[model samples]
Target: MATAINVQSSCSEAEWKARQRLAACYRIFAYLGWDEMIFNHITLKVPGEDDAFLINPYGLHFSEVTASTLVKIDIDGNTLDGSTYPVNKAGFTQHSLFHRELPDVHAIIHTHTTATMAVSSVEGGLQPINFYAAAIVPRLAYHKFEGITVHDDEGPRFLASLGKKRMMLLENHGPVVMGRTLEQAFLNHWVLQRACEIQMQTLAMGKPVMIGQEVIDKHMANLSQASIDPVQQGVPEFDAMVRLVDREDTSWRE
Candidate 1:
């Protein structure tokens, strides 16, 4: 980690701040036990850059990520920063594809958490039994799994599956959440993950009590009108998680 720290780069103050937020996001992922070792990724679009995006270095643990260690890459999946670490193939295919096509998306979080993967493998995908599920069900999209995404051909299919939706479940794979900011992405992941967890738990207790369509539709409508700012809706929990990471180790700020 030290070797990668403070490496020479021409990233602007805004981009550098984006790096810090992305790094903190990785740390908070670890804090919440949502990290899956070196697998999975959380990415942010670089401020003021058209094609450049910031992602975690391929081999590092979520806890090991830092502002200075993030790697910048372009739409072509080429590393723009002269870092020793390589970017994950799947990360580029899934993240860069969306960032390139969706002009409004600024951040993305992909995870293979236990509950989320379980839901992905199940029929009907995420359920609408709980408030969390109902709130997110309206924006949910499903993409059939096409093995490991290494080829360029999967790009268009991935984007099409996620068409205009902020949350997607990759069939037999995992869930991906897109947001206008890292804060929003994290919040989206939290809601999606919890919804899956609740569905799994409720199923374990014999048949689950399904919420009615009228009630579920009402909640969905309310969520649509709620504040979109992650800071406004998620700051209370996000700040607490940041504090937890800081207490453990502030290396993520490097």
Candidate 2:
């Protein structure tokens, strides 16, 4: 691990808290085996700032990311904080589009897990066969892959395809989800990953037992009315995972 620097004095309270949350997200992603080496990204917008956000510095494993090491940047790709590591340009392009278009989304997760990528490559995208899939299927959208999303021009098409959906399947690529909070973002990814795994396994065996739309709609109605606070929703499970991360290594809290 790199030497963890003390940055408390240098950053505002909001920015510092954002750093801590974003860093914890990185560690949690690593702990859950959701990290894709130094690639892929999870970004959290600064608490009170419209344009500023925190993202993992390129080349650092999610496990090595500490609160002090995350790079702060704006939507224009300018580095706001003094971190020597470069931001992944393609990642910034995709994430920035959402951040700019969707002002309410405070956290965004883009992942390329094996099962999610497998589902993305096939037709039908994400199905509402399972409970987990049903909860998010109503809000999911899809965008065709047009090579790497490195150019600024790609942002418009991405935004157009995304519409208002927070959960998106990137064809031939992977999945991306935005959340109102860091905890929600992590939870969304976890649930989506599990849903994808179930679909892949069931399809391998034979035609899977699919849940009917009426049942899905009934469940979704309750889900829509139900509170989804990352701390309280889904059996209040995110906090337990956070506790597990703290137990393993509290360095992420730095």
| For every candidate, C-alpha RMSD to the true structure in Å | 1.8, 2.0
Span of ten consecutive residues with least summed lDDT in model 1: 1-10
**Candidate 2: misplaced stretches above 4 Å?**
1-5, 228-235
Model 2 agreement with the true structure over 184-252: per-residue lDDT tens digits: 777788889999998898898888777888998899899768766555443356667778899989998
Error at 237, model 1, angstroms: 3.1
C-alpha local distance difference test of each model: 0.86, 0.85
Which whole-number lDDT from 0 to 100 does residue 22 have in model 2? 83
- TM-scores of all predicted structures: 0.94, 0.94
Give one digit per residue, the lDDT tens place, for model 1 in 113-216.
Answer: 99999999999988788878888787899999999877789888888888889899998999999888787788889999999999999888887777788988
Clashes of 2: 0
Residue 124, candidate 2: C-alpha displacement in angstroms: 1.0
